[model samples]
Target: MNVDFWNEKFTQTPGLYGEEPNRFLKIQLQSLSPGYLLLPGEGEGRNALFAASKGWKVLALDQSPIAKKHTLEKARKNGLDIEYQVCDIEKFIHEGTKFDVIALIYFHLPSSIRAQIHARFEAMIKENGLLIIEGFGKNQLKFSSGGPKNTEMLYAIKEIKSDFPGITWEYEFEGNDILNEGIGHSGEADLVRLVGRKLSDYLIKISN
Candidate 1:
């Protein structure tokens, strides 16, 4: 979707997506230590603000300027300061940066862009860093809660495994159910969730 599309969506309903972290994200990140957390496609700042409340330094990025404004306002209202940027993910550079934890929650782009983004993500993580992703599955087309209509935009376990070959898969699963992430992500939805870690030197050396 383009900036105008999202701007119109946010304008139609000031908080169309609501102000709360994704359920899956909250659950998976709770046990991890606080550190630099990156939230790509972080619409409306719910997840970023939530992480901020937990003392995590967050960098939220999105393409919509309107989204950037609203997210900042939301963070301010919660007495939190979250670093937000308005940039197209395709053009954003991820060089000389490493994150302890990176999150890709409900960010769907075309396969071509997705492949490139995944590669950058792999390079951006420090050894043993975590990657948490939750998105619509290929089967989501059959369900109607929310997500890209294109099957190619959705994710699968095998696809993720192939994309991040050096990462040790910690968790992977799919299910259909109501997602109570405020309001937007609700009702019966087909989703895929994964938590993985970059392989450490010990494991890499062993493999060799």
Candidate 2:
């Protein structure tokens, strides 16, 4: 994670990702019951703030202090209280804590450690928990929109399925879409979206 890069990003702009929540996230959350929602790399707090407003206990983590500060400021103005931590995602650990939902919207990471971080996040989900993700597809290189320039940082559907095995995929697709999240993510983009539910521990045991 580049703290300086994100620090400057959030500080330089009022809302780099905009104040509105991701469209996919908003739709999914609307139908599901509100519970503990965990958002990693929650830059600028748009999604986290939306979850908080919807009566979900939101817990967000980011590497940039400026991002956290901006998030808190937004929460305060919205009259919402959200738990936020400024730290590396790898170093964040909540012992014996589990969440009902984990959102990974646009949380692109270096390929070297993305798998490890994902596995750790998977372990934090309670039985039947939902994992929602939306990120730039491997084909995103063709577009001049937001996302990392490194192909390794982008996502592929096959890799997502392999990364979170033993879960039932409720929805999964990879295609192009017009994204207008903010000044950062605007225009047409190759996107990958997924929603998976963790199999119950008992079910896994019995199947094994």
Candidate 3:
């Protein structure tokens, strides 16, 4: 909910993380058919535009209005359409709409609400839908690659898995990688990547 910070950040650069979609997201979608995809904390529309290009109905959200402006500008140039909104991600997570895919790429949240938000995102996905994520991992503080400097915001595989017990993890890895997305992401980084499927409607509801 740090709107002012991220809004100022978007102004400082035309492309903070570059216009390219996350490589992990690109790879994961290749094997699946395009469907309704929701991207939260979507910073400049890179992933949204990419998904829309491939014929997926994309809804992108971020707290910064500037981010939406930049994304829409790029989408226009590329002849892509993405529904973008400027609002708190937590608020949007509780909406009634269901999606066929949900992706979170470097979208770090405070520890206080991380589990609840993650669980809500899980609830929003359709049965048999996919959830893919790529983010800075627990060991990222040792690396120079870009991520929230706050340790609590960094993801841990065990914690993330615990957040979504209903998920059938198709792929999971915590490793080091060389990031080259843009000026914001460069050099070696510790990352956690996962691709999971919500295979059925009979999941045990998350606790309050």
Best by TM-score: 2
* Candidate 3 TM-score to native: 0.95
Clashes of each: 0, 0, 0
Which residue pairs in candidate 3 collide? none
Name the regions of candidate 1 deviating beyond 4 angstroms.
Answer: 201-208
Per-residue alpha-carbon lDDT of model 1 for 1-208, expressed as tens digits? 7899988887777776667778889987799889989999998888998899999989899998888899898778879989898998878776655889989999888987777788777777889899998998888888767788788888786886687766888898887777766556667888888899988756756875
After superposing candidate 2, which stretches have Cα over 4 Å from the reference?
A: 205-208
lDDT (Cα atoms) of all candidates against the true structure: 0.83, 0.89, 0.89
Ranking of all candidate structures by their TM-score, best first: 2, 3, 1
Of the two candidates 1 and 3, the one with more favorable TM-score, higher being better, is 3
| C-alpha lDDT of candidate 3 relative to the true structure | 0.89
TM-score for each predicted model, relative to the true structure: 0.92, 0.96, 0.95
- Tens digits of per-residue lDDT for model 3 on 1-208? 4998888989998698988899999998877898999999998998999899999999998999999999999999989989998888667744666899999999999999999999888888899999999999988999887999998999999999899877899899999999988888989999999999985766455422
Error of 2 at 70 (Å): 0.8
Where in model 3 is the C-alpha error above 4 Å? 93-96, 203-208
Model 1 lDDT-worst window of ten: 177-186
